[model samples]
Structures are given as C-alpha cells and as structure tokens.
Target: MKNIRDSHFKLHTTSPSYPILASTELGILHAKDHGEWHSINAFNLSQKLRDFIKNNTEIFEIDDVFFKSGLYFSDPNKVWIKCNLLTGKELREILCDKYGIYLSRYTKKHILINFHFGVTEECLDTLISALSQIEKNTLSRNFSLNENELSEYFVIPYPPGVPFIFPGQKISKNDINNIKKHQDEKNILIYIKEVI
Candidate 1:
C-alpha cells in the first residue's frame, strides 16, 4: 500500500521488462539493475491534474518510493513525491483540499553518498564567493567505505537514495581509497576529523 494508508499504483499497460512500472501516461519507464526504479513524473501539482488514483485496493510499491510519502531534504519545501498512480491534481485535491497537505512535484536533486566536506570558515568564504570546494590536505584522518556493501534498511535519505552508515555493518573500510577515488567527480567530498 502507498504511505497514505489507502492508495497504490496499478499498471494500466505492460512492458518488456518490469511490468509493474510500464505506463505510457506516467512515464514510469524502467528500473535499474540494482532494483532501483526511476521514472519521469508525468504530472506536476503546479499544473492541473486528472484523477489517476483508481478506486481499488491493489497496493504495489517500487521498493524505496511511494506516491504520497514525505522524503528528507533538510526542508519541507523540498519534499517530493514520485508517481505510481495518483496525478498531481488528484493528489492536491485529495490531500490538500481534504486533508491539508503540501506536496511538491518531483524536484530533481543531486544527492551525494558517504561524503561530506567540513563546514569550515574557509569553506564558508569559498561558498560566499561561490568558488569550488576546498581541498583535503590531511591524509591521516581520511576514511573510506565499501561501495558494494550496505544494510537492508540502513540510514538513507531519498533523491540519491543511498545508504548512510549504520552500526554493526561492515559497510566501511579503513582504507580511504573508495572516497578519494571519486573526489574529482562533481560535488563529491569527504571530511577527516581532527584530533586534539
């Protein structure tokens, strides 16, 4: 069932692959190899919408996403919902007019995984000037993670949908290579804690 407690996706058509997400109308095209499914939202709440949520009891969720569930993004205004059945207008009418909800259309976000640059004075100054991120010069404090390891339901935020570190899991390694290997990529940065 959808997080709304009484709503879900129903496929009106079939696909050569994942048959559950094949809908020409919704642009729910396909799935990734790791069972990470993605789709282009056909309906935006900013625009008028149609009643796409059927009056049935069939509940089908595509793993880590739901039609009307809230996701983390540091702000409520950045909350997004992916479509399975309900249209933007239908969602607004049902959830907003009736139940008082404020769900925005899918806001494409660039989520980084297992990486965070320290918020230092220099970093702030660079941000004020809008310069590129500061470099990591300290080698003794670097950390790394196993790209192919994670818990079944580890601490993860949506958008990038990557797993955050959790206790009791061997998802991390003592080597800093995994993180440094991707540092040159867009917005990928890691901070090494300092010792007193």
Candidate 2:
C-alpha cells in the first residue's frame, strides 16, 4: 500500500523533489498559521472594492461591470471588472502607464484584479481613485468583416488562447457568427492583414 501510494504520487507530480518540498512546507505554514486571517482580510477587501465600484458607477460610466460569482458563494481573492467602452488591453495599458498599477487582462473587455494577503486599504483607495479618473478614449477603427469575408482575417481570443478564424482558412456561417458574437461581447481581438 505504501509503495503504491508513493508510485501514484510520483506519477501525478510534475515538479522536482526539492522545489516541491519547499513549496509544500510553505503551503503548510500558510494553511496552518495564517489561512483564516488572510481569508477574512481578503474577503473584506474584495467586498469593499466591489462596493466602491458599484456605488461609483457614474465614475466608471458602465452598468453591470463587475462579474458576480454567485449570490451565496464568491471568490474574494480576485475580481473581474468588465470594460464596456475600452478594451482590456487599452484599460490595462492606461492603468499601468497612468497610475503605475498593473492589472491582468482576462479578456478583451474584462480586467482582473487580484487581492493578496498584504493588500491594504490605502492600496484599494489608490485603485479607486485611479479608476475614477479614467475617461474613454477613441478606439481605432477596423474594417468590419462579414461571415463571407472572414477568410482573409485572423481572429483570436487572448485569454483562452484560441483562434476562432485563421487566415486562409474557410469559416462557416456558424463559426463566423461565433466570432462576431465574441467580438460584440468584447471578448476577442480581431487581426486584419492591413492592420497587422
């Protein structure tokens, strides 16, 4: 039984022994000593951020921006904010360039903010202030391609790293519709020959 368990563990594990040992030790320390405290703090901070954003929708100028986890259970470690007017790339660039705060782009229209154990109220305040100062900038115009016209362009969704339409590949009406739907949802970036 012991040998079987050992063989199974080795087969399932990918990391080398030394690093895995160190990581396991750290995980144990965190879980045993600081898990509850960190959980509570992260939960409160995430809630505060959600509340701030919700209350200041005028500042954001977008309704239903934040992605809700559920009514009863929510992940307090990360929050996803939807970008209606600006793409996620644009929003991330603006936040990094202007506010010196970097955010993860979850999709073309969604930016992810992560809450760490060390996150403070002041950090949240700075984020709120930066978000309030953001104004919509004009997006560059791209030639719209219809279902029949999609063969010339390459459409890729960044977050999931999937290509919807590859250049020179024939796309069916359904595939074209899916691409258009994703684009309309601000969930993809379409690349054209001229633009590239």
Candidate 3:
C-alpha cells in the first residue's frame, strides 16, 4: 500500500475572484456536499484545489477523518492547513501581501508540503513543471521535497472530508473497502499507490 505519510498534502485556498476560472466554471458550483447531480470525483477535486491555489486567495480549516488528524482538524466552513515550520513566515507574507488573505490563528507545527496536484497525468505534470520554474531567489524553497520521493503515497481525493493519508501507515482494510464502496456508489475515485 502507498505510504500514507508520504501522500500527506496541504491545499491552497484562493479567493473566489481568481481569473483562472471561467464564468462557466464559477457558475459550476457544487454544494459543499456533492449531491446526485455531481460527485466529488478525484480528478476534478484536485483540479479545483490547484486552480484555487494558483489563482486565488483562499483559506482552509483543518479537517480530521480516517484517524489522521482526528476530529480536531475537521471544520466544514474552515480549512486547517500545515506549512513547513520554516516557511510559515514567508507563506504568511505571500498570502497576505500577494493574495490579501488572512490565515487562521491556529499555529502550524509541521513542514507538511501540501502539493495539491491533480490526480491526472496532465495536471500532475503541470504541477511539477510549475514547481521546477519557481526561482529559489524569488521564493523560499523550504516546502520543497525530493521529486523522486513523491510517489511514496498517492494523493487521495475524499471531499467534504479532507484527503487523508500518511507515509508508512497502512490503510485500514475497512477504509479501503469503504473507499471502494463510495467509488461504486458515487463515482468517486481515491488515488492509491504503494509507498516506495
């Protein structure tokens, strides 16, 4: 199974005004809870998250599910995010000055790099290419991780509930079955890969 820890990711919160999203996309809002009309499929969910991070000023409250963060991180209206302890100051500055968004008051304790990359091959490439282009002088690279190490855990998209996993941790058999059941019933897909 994929090392759940290696798959841990933080999402970028963006403003609803980002220009990257088309009027049609902006109008294509899904209820916080995916209904019968649309399901929180893995591909689309990651894409929306990537778009929000690359183009808008958004914030998220931490969510806890799957015994990951426990219930402490779950907040429907709020998103809890973790940044590299070292990059906290700079990230705070970028979000505030560049995006004009305020971070939550909660303290960040880890260096978790939330690579909110999409599950599709194309989106994954886009994310990697963008990461390569970031100039070290212009941006802090504290959150950077070895590219080769990224495949250790696959990014899972479980919406309404934050994506959950940690490297080296085994996915409970029950969770696996539940995920599969959700896929069969709601057309939702949870990405998984063995932890190298």
Candidate 4:
C-alpha cells in the first residue's frame, strides 16, 4: 500500500476545473471511489508507463474496453493498471489465473518522486508561492492556449488529467509526441497558465 500524505503539488485547478482535482500534489490511491486512474510522479515513470501501456494494450482493449495506465502513485511499488471493467470479477480472474498478475481486493497506492510536471526547481518555487496567494478554486491558465500548443500545461479530463507544463519546464520532445498522439481528439483542452 502506498502512503498517502499531503503534498505540495505545483499546479492547482481553478474555476474551469473540478475542485476535487485541484490539489493533485496530494498522493493518490487506487480506490474504486477514486476511479481507476492513479497519480504517479511521472518522472522516470513516463517511459515505463508508455511501455506498460504498449504491452498491455491487448489486455486493456478487450470488449471495447481500454484504460489509461498513467494514474496512481504514492508508492511507485504499486504499479497502476486500469481495465474498463472494474465492476467485473472476470478481470481479476483472468489476470491472476492466466497472466499471473497479483490480485488484491483493495486498491493500491504509489509513492513517487514529486515532479512538477517537468518543472525545474526554481519554477516549482514560483508556482508554490503564487499558489499560496491565489484563490482556493481559482486557476491561472498558462503556457499554451490551444491544442496546437499541447506541451504547455493543458488540463485534460481526470483519467489522464495531468502533465501540465509549469513555468520553468521546457516542452520536451516526448511532450510533443504525447500531444501529437491525441491531436485528432477534439475534446482535449489545453489551457495557457497565467503565470504570476
């Protein structure tokens, strides 16, 4: 089980976003109520995550059911995997019986290195300081504004609701690839953070 603790996550969700998702800095658990997505520090985990996603595409793509594998992390030991069918026991049975996946009735948590979505140390400080004065639910959009500039901090729907670029973070080539992967998805909204 991953240790859940209060964290100083860099970005905060504003009015345009859901309050529940505001302070993503906090550690995450894989509880059903929290949905299948878990928050991991996405640092070294991004490559691992991409590999896991590629490897398990068949497992996840069953019956029109595919899930994003990039969510939970309080303890990196707890690898996050999501199958669209959480309510079904078949998933557990198949994983355990056929693929030798460990089975657990309880949701797992992951403890990961705190990453400011690739933000550098100095920028993280700026975000934290700015976050202190900002209204609880108010968000300052920054970096990029539209789908064209996806590398800049854009908030997507929860399942994969992160990867926003903080002030000091430069857009990596991988960031461009991630955005390009979903370029056709009209629903992905990328907001430009209004830096202080």
lDDT of 2 by residue, 1-196 (tens): 7864575567556654655666777998987898899788878988887887777643232223434555755455678877655667877888899899987655766688888877888888888877777732222235365655547766665457566677777667887678667768876363544222
Per-residue CA lDDT of candidate 1, range 1-196, in tens? 3532322334333433343332532342323332131112211211111111122111111122324536633321122333223333553444445444333432222111111122233332332222111111221223444555642223322224353445345555532343444443433332312110
- Which candidate gets the maximum TM-score versus the true structure? 2
Please report the TM-score between candidate 4 and the true structure.
0.21
* lDDT by candidate, in order shown: 0.29, 0.66, 0.38, 0.37
Q: Which ten-residue region of model 3 has the weakest summed lDDT?
A: 136-145
Q: After superposition, how far is residue 195 of candidate 1 from its true place, in Å?
A: 56
Runs in model 2 with CA error above 4 Å?
A: 1-27, 59-74, 135-196
- The reply for model 1, stretches above 4 Å from the true place, is 1-79, 104-196
Q: What lDDT tens digits, residue by residue, belong to model 4 across residues 75-104?
A: 332334433312235444544564444345
- In order of appearance, the predictions have TM-scores of 0.17, 0.49, 0.24, 0.21
Residue 192 accuracy (lDDT) in model 4: 34
Candidate 1 pairs with clashing backbones: none
How far off is model 1, as Cα RMSD?
22.9
What is the lDDT for 168 in model 1?
Answer: 43
